[model samples]
Target: MLDIFRGLKSLIKISHIHIDSAVFRLHYSLTVILLIAFSLIVTTRQYVGNPIDCIHSKDLPEDVLNTYCWIHSTYTITAAYRKREGLEVPFPGVDNSKSYSETERKEYKYYQWVCFMLFLQAILFYTPRWLWKGWEGGKIHALMMDLDIGLCSEVEKKQKKKMLLDYLWENLRFHNWWAYRYYLCEVLALLNVIGQMFLMNRFFDGAFLTFGIDVLRFLESDQEDRVDPMIYVFPRMTKCTFYKYGVSGEVERHDAVCILPLNVVNEKIYVFLWFWFLFLGVLSFFTVLYRILIIFSPRTRVYLLRMRFRLVRRDAVETIVRRSKVGDWFLLYMLGENLDTVIYRDVMHELANKLASRHHHGVKGELQEA
Candidate 1:
């Protein structure tokens, strides 16, 4: 188990440079790592101890009854949740009486599938990053022109700066598709979070969507009136029925009280995930909204550039914004993120001057022609 977790530690390390927002990295990197770690921890028998254990009658084989209950799943009586734990019910869902109707019993089968489901969810969270990386195809890296390494020779730095400026001048407005793809990936991340939440709700028999909310409400409610949402959703104890043949060839029904130790880990994992997904959903939502602002408002682009690279002059930023399209600004903004602020300021100043010169020359030619 220590070796496995040590391997997982490598995944959480910052092994590569990131070209996306923190929120984006949260989805593809941190969230994926967390999900996989939880899955592995739960799947490991040493950590989880036993998946399920049941108390059986002296007549029944304990191992056989435990295995049967684990394979077939266990159930909780709904009305038992309202009863006090120490008084009417030994636990949240344990009942020895056979008087409860089948309609009142809720079967729990999610435990067996928890690890598999978590792995699947990790893949889903990473899908957007994969798509974005494929579509981006090293565009930012190629355009960076080794400027990311600021220790280059002065001659090389000058030459690289000229090349970068020339590329920007020649390719203005051409990066709309590239920028759009990244934005689309951001939107996809938000959708993926929402979709996963919905899937988890269904997977947990509709208990997950509001799991966090119920937990919060439970925390604030009077203890006497409250039913623990965690226990309700992930009961630590439940009832299972196993059947076998008697010595006389008659069928015997054995009711067993099963303890689900895995749910202890499960409840914590999901409660944290519920809050995390909600946070990511909101962050992604605002990120998309900010993207829309960047698209529709030129002043927003100028303001963002100025804010991000304070050394860049306001007029220089405005000049670039005035002369370029949203795609060009987006590319430049991304480039600014990769380049040092001082170097970026120099690049922006030179680009602004070059654009001004071009505009002047074009106007002079038109005047001469007229």
Candidate 2:
């Protein structure tokens, strides 16, 4: 309890976020927080109150009622039924007319498994981000942060561009070689999404087997204003057999139904998560492509910066930056780095104007010589 309070106090002491957090990290944090909230509070509430409520005989003895509830809670009966099948003793075989259906066996723990899977999903998403942060956080991030600060502090445009060019040449090349390591993290993130699509399908129902086409089918069915049992996030009820207990150790039996309220919550949670994973999966897919283009091909680099920053002189940019000098700068910029593109745009414009002036002057000199 004291430790909990200490942790809360430390959180209160936080003034601001120093490091620029990425999109994936933010998503991972939200996922973990929601998982904790639902597991600890939402699903847990269903287990509160009575575990078993016996019915049938209004005048059933209180002792027998309590005993039945306790016994039924012991075994996990899913969905099996028997009908007054056992022999009853004439002595203390006073089998109460009341009985409860208890078909689910040991499967009572399934609701908790939902929480475990969601928690696992959140952790898996974070794994790649942590890997990238571990590699980039200490080295590339710090260096880019310093460049961002220095570039901003400079007053002269020439000095600012010079600083950027120096850093672009000196540090960016070394880091760009290892940039694929970061993309490996993106690959992991992409796999995490793809994996969840199938994982949820296997765990809950077959709807996820189509990898999102099933989700569309579910929506179309919803337009008809009908419930589709096939698309439910979790299995709600299961079948099991009730053990008829009385004097002489046994008496009667009946059909039973095991209700899981967690299934209701699971339906809502997984539906949202399924779509969420799809969105992230698509985004990660393209991010990998762009990362590849920026690293290996200079022409591709120029094209992306022209589109991304909306620069005017693509031809000049293509001439100025061959491999990844500008590509490296733009690459870090796109990955939630603190660098400002306004400075880069201004520098590119100035360079393009200079190149244009030199070309015009050379053309005029050639005409005079002729």
Candidate 3:
């Protein structure tokens, strides 16, 4: 028991020693500052305007005022719906059917503010790592190019081809499996999107009325019509419009004739884009799946057996050649093994000698020899 306790103590001490002081301090400071800044921003944004004041104002409805209050509170925290109009609007509710208390609004606003700050911080933190990975990938690509050039000797061609075949075989195992699954998923998503289109149409029809005559006409009509409908209709519509001549009794409706067609076209375009993107994504996914399956499948086992048989046949031929000329075979084997190491040097020397020979022999003799 004492030994176990001692071991735990040692492990803890080792872990503590491994922790970098600079990194730990920097992380702690950044976390503290982020927290402090977020809190301050949230607090300021939340209670900037009083919900009670907006509610009491005759210019807006109780529901509208309450909605503004609620939205202000909610967005102060979440901030997902943050927009220029949202900031200016006294009420935050979409259609003003709901009202928010001052306390609720404040809390919501704070929540949104915190959410926004966290989202921004997350992006900032991840961007550096993403950039570093891109740089490393570029360097790796350059290294691969150098390696390919160095390895491109005639003697090393057979070995290089064998290595490439091995790599392809391994990758194919994963690809095959991935392709099958990806095809299945793509078919399902296509069916789902088709089903959703019908449902989306119904949803738009239901919601369209609210935005059309109700909201637009209210904006296009006179001041009396613009006044809170609940206040005017429930209490005194006759008194409100009594003095105005030819007020048409019918509210001046702003024809959103363009809206329905525009919305339909937009929806069609969005669905088209969605299908296109989903198809591309599935194509890529399937390609990878097919490669994976080829690498791991039983079918690949048979393919590898064939490869082994071919390799053995080639080895037998090489063995016969080696037996016929043992010394030459040993030299050839050594040269093949270190082909990349000597290829550039040999090429340069050979080219220089040829050029010198050509200079001495003259262009006519050099051409005849070639």
Best by lDDT: 1
Off by over 4 Å in 1: 13-16, 45-48
Best by TM-score: 1
lDDT of 2 by residue, 1-370 (tens): 3443344333233212223235455445655555555554443554554433333343345446543433443232222222121453111111222342423233333444665776677677668767866766554444344444444545554565665555544554455545666667767777887887888777643545553456566567744353343323344443334445666787656434344454566667666666767777777778767667766777776676577666446765664455236435444444323444565565556655555676689999999999
TM-score of 1: 0.96
Q: How close is candidate 2 to the true structure, as a TM-score?
A: 0.62
Q: Report how far off residue 334 is in candidate 2 (Å).
A: 4.5
Q: Residue by residue across 211-279, what tens digits does model 3's lDDT show?
A: 223434656778533533221111110100011123567543210000011222232333343343344
TM-score of each: 0.96, 0.62, 0.22
Best first by TM-score, ranked = 1, 2, 3
User: Of models 1 and 3, which has the larger TM-score?
Assistant: 1
Tens-place lDDT digits, model 1, residues 1-370: 7888889876776734456888999999999999999999888952456788898878887778877888888999998888888898899777755778888999998888899999999999999999998988987888787787688999999998898889998998788888899999999999999999999999999999999999999999999999999998899999998888999999988788999888898999999999999999999999999999999999889888888888999988898899989888878888888886677889999999988899999999999999
The order by descending lDDT is 1, 2, 3
lDDT of 1: 0.88
Overall lDDT per candidate, in order of appearance: 0.88, 0.52, 0.33
Which should have the higher lDDT, number 1 or number 3?
A: 1
